[model samples]
Target: MRRSGFLSLVLASALAVPSLACAADHVTGALKGTNGAVHGIVDVTGAPKGVLLRLQVQGLTPGWHGIHFHEKGSCAPPKFTSAGAHVHAATPVVHGLLNADANDAGDLPNLYVAADGTATVELYSTLVSLKGGNNLPALMDADGASVVIHAKPDDYQTQPIGGSGDRVACAVLH
Candidate 1:
């Protein structure tokens, strides 16, 4: 019985070795608005399925807002257009996450802020990765990427940002 127990322990240790070798990578960035205020922080970590995101934000109008991963890491103030469009793979992707013919990899659920203008949430997406792998767009690619928070909520089925309106906050993750 002791020998059997030792063998089991050794087998378990061997199995854990591969997972340790493929440790999850991580990246983080500070979220800012057009006013240049550091209103929040965004932390991203790699996962076996994809990536996980944690956001803690404040100082907003206090309602539902659209959030997504953009194609570039640049976040010019006034308007975050410098961050570019949503991240996508080699194949052309449509805008809406709920659309039958579309569902871009960058589309994520809307974020909600309280009346006091504060929000803390964690989101996970299997469509993207922190590093380039399995044909997924790397959030930390050569050009890197940015997380954009829109002024309005995402309808999830509309075209061109789901009518989420202007880019109000951005976090560069290069």
Candidate 2:
């Protein structure tokens, strides 16, 4: 089978298998840019020990960009600061995916955009949940969470945003 077909089969299986005690197995939403444009779509599913994400987006700068799960689900345009910081525990809250003492569950790897200004990628996080469980924070909590895209790439070892620049696009995980 083609790669896309195979991936569809895999994703279908994943969506069907996991059963969370509360809430649906997954959540999906649209991505909007700071300029108030719809860029793409996002699908988030509850996985065995974590969460799975599949995203397809366009109109980027065609390079590496930082992506993360933010503390708040609000994606107020212009400046996504309303989304708050990374979704992290109250303690052990050091940033950077490469940090030894790292405890920020919202940290994710850099997302690469094609020369055509589009990106299609799958990511998994072993630190969060959909409706909140396993002592991990919930991406779909009372206030909710969001997937934010940055202007620059994440160094993965730097503090905070890793110089990822501005928050360009956001998708609230409702």
Candidate 3:
């Protein structure tokens, strides 16, 4: 109605646009297992170095579990073979956090579940990219990616999954 009120409204709408755009830069996944499910969210806004991953999972074994981003976004129940291997950016490397040469882009820290079989964790990854920059593999590629939870902890020194046991849970990221 008034010029001052119209200008204020315009300014407020303009300020809200960036936050709305940032919210669109996020991806979500629903991790499912035989017993329970987990909700995963990845925020790629302002990812100058990396992305932020937030996860809330239930019905675990109450111990350490290895987590990674699989190369494919297909999550088949039971085995999850459709999810493929861990994501690699440039070249094939060893699977370990302490490797001297290199580690898989999808390699991540262990997730610990409490006695109640619930875990809420936030993690950051600097290897892969959401916008597909710096020669890194994009999580939103043609094949996409999946977040996988293993049955055992990664020793960070062994080859090919670092002694991580069977795939317990998986969520295809879009």
Candidate 4:
């Protein structure tokens, strides 16, 4: 009887481990522009190093669109300046992926939109946290954060958004 009880406990523990690692938090947003509509879902999963960001977006212009996590969560539209600047976890950093000095925490690779105007991409970062602790920038901060899409592609080496034109679409990430 004791041996069978031990085996059962071991099996249960093994089974639960995978589920714990697979646990993820999700947030949804509706991207709206003056003449277009888009929707997005961001899935955050904790990893040993940092976190994984899985994004799915639909209804965007076909091409490369610059995407970043803005400071505020408000998608007020008509320019979306309310979403502040790109997120910086610790000290201020220059805005460029190719920059040797620093890169913004919110900086992500350019989102490639297909001819159908839909995209699904995955990215990882160790700068920010969804768990909201450890002095890290949380997705669910006091004012929240936002995912903004620009009209042009991010050059990854230019200053202040890589000349990505126009705030095309924005979605509040709560």
Each prediction's whole-model lDDT (CA): 0.89, 0.88, 0.81, 0.77
- Displacement of residue 156 (Cα, Å) in model 2 is 1.1
Task: List runs of model 4 lying over 4 Å from the truth.
Answer: 1-24, 90-92, 132-135
Q: Rank the candidates by TM-score, best first.
A: 3, 2, 1, 4
Off by over 4 Å in 3: 35-46
Deviation in Å, model 1, residue 7 alpha carbon: 22
lDDT of 1: 0.89
**Candidate 3 C-alpha lDDT tens digits along 34-55:** 4544534333332767677788
List, in order, the clash count of every candidate structure.
Answer: 0, 0, 0, 0
Q: Residue 89 in model 4: shift from native, Å?
A: 3.2
Tell me the spans in candidate 2 whose CA falls farther than 4 Å from its real position.
1-23
For model 1, give the RMSD to the true fold. 4.2
lDDT per residue (tens digit) for residues 43-151 in model 2 = 8998768899999999988999999999998899999899999999776467788878888899989999999999999999998988788888888888889999999
Give the backbone clash total of model 3.
Answer: 0
Task: Name the candidate, 1 or 3, with the larger lDDT value.
Answer: 1
User: What RMSD, rounded to one decimal, does every model reach?
Assistant: 4.2, 8.2, 2.1, 3.8
lDDT of 4 by residue, 62-166 (tens): 999898888898877689999998888766668878788765877888889899988898888676766566666777678878888899999987878888889
What TM-score, computed on C-alpha atoms, does each candidate reach?
Answer: 0.84, 0.85, 0.91, 0.77
